[model samples]
Target: MRAFVSMLSGILFGFGLALSGMMDPSRVRGFLDIFGDWDPTMAFVMGGAVIVMAIAWRMQKAMNKPVVCDQFSLPGTKLIDARLIGGAALFGIGWGLAGLCPGPAVASLANNLSGAAIFVAAMIAGMVIFRLTERPAQ
Candidate 1:
């Protein structure tokens, strides 16, 4: 049941990404092109996501447990540390260069995008390296 829900959620999320043109690298790049031909589509998409998540947060606080899980597996810490900052910076840099973040990049794989395979491979390698070198949380 949990697996089915997970698969359904993934399918819905992928469909949304594709429908929103997020699977297109050029569209994402345009959104990041602040100094040039900027695209506002992503802004709307992001804004909608923020709105939905804001509501979700409110509802989550009211709920005792999640529908599909025993408990909500949200982030444990609110700490702002060097590792967090560095990871965010790295993610931003990759997003700017590749025009696709993790979610969209994974969805782009199904489309057989030209550079997506390489990007995903490199992303996976980076994750593996990070896991290998990660320090124990303090």
Candidate 2:
């Protein structure tokens, strides 16, 4: 049941991304090009997502526990440390350059873009490198 729900949720999220024009790297790049022909469509997409998330969060809070899980799987850490900032900066830079974040990069695989394939391969390589280099948190 949990796996089914997880897969369904992923499909829904991907569908939303596609519907919002987020699956296209060119669309995202246009949004980032503020000095050029800047596009504000992504902003509207983000705003709509934020609104939906806010409402969902409130409703989830009203519940004692999740329907699928016995307990919530929320992250415990709240502090914004240097590590977090550095990682986020790296992510933003990569997004700006590639015009595709992890979600969209994976979603765009169906489009058979060669760049997307390279990006996904590099992303997987980076993940493996990070796992091998970093020690597990105590």
Candidate 3:
């Protein structure tokens, strides 16, 4: 049941990405192009996501445990650290360069096979490097 729900959520998210044009690198690049032909489509998509997430967070706080889990698994730290900053900077640079973030890159794999494949490969490599270098939680 939990697996089914997870699959459904992923499918809905992928469908939203496709319908919102987030799967298109050109459209994403246009959204980032503030000084040029800037597109506001992505902004609307992000706004909607923020709103939905805000509501979800509120509901989460009201719950003692998740519907399909023993307890909610969430980030334990709220600290601002060098590792976080560096990772965020790297992510931003990659997004600017390819105009494809991890979610959309994976979701668009079928739409742009070669480009998405390269992006996913690089993304996985980065993740592996991070895992290899990261210190164990104290």
lDDT of 2 by residue, 14-60 (tens): 89888999888889999999999999999999999899999998988
Candidate 1 global CA lDDT score: 0.91
Q: Note each model's CA RMSD in angstroms.
A: 1.2, 1.5, 1.4
Model 1 ranges with Cα > 4 A deviation: none
Tens digits of lDDT, candidate 1, 1-138 = 999999999999999999998888899999999999999999999998999999999999999999989988887767898888999999998998989899999999988666888899999999999899988977
lDDT of 3 at 131: 88
- Residue-level lDDT tens digits of model 3 in 19-124: 9898888898999999999999999999999999999999999999999889899988779988789889988888888989999999979789999999999999
Residue 17 lDDT (model 3): 91
User: What global local distance difference test value does model 2 have?
Assistant: 0.90
Q: Please report the TM-score between candidate 2 and the true structure.
A: 0.92
lDDT of 3 at 67: 91
TM-score of 1: 0.93
Q: How do these models rank on TM-score, best leading?
A: 1, 3, 2
What ranges in model 2 sit over 4 Å off?
136-138
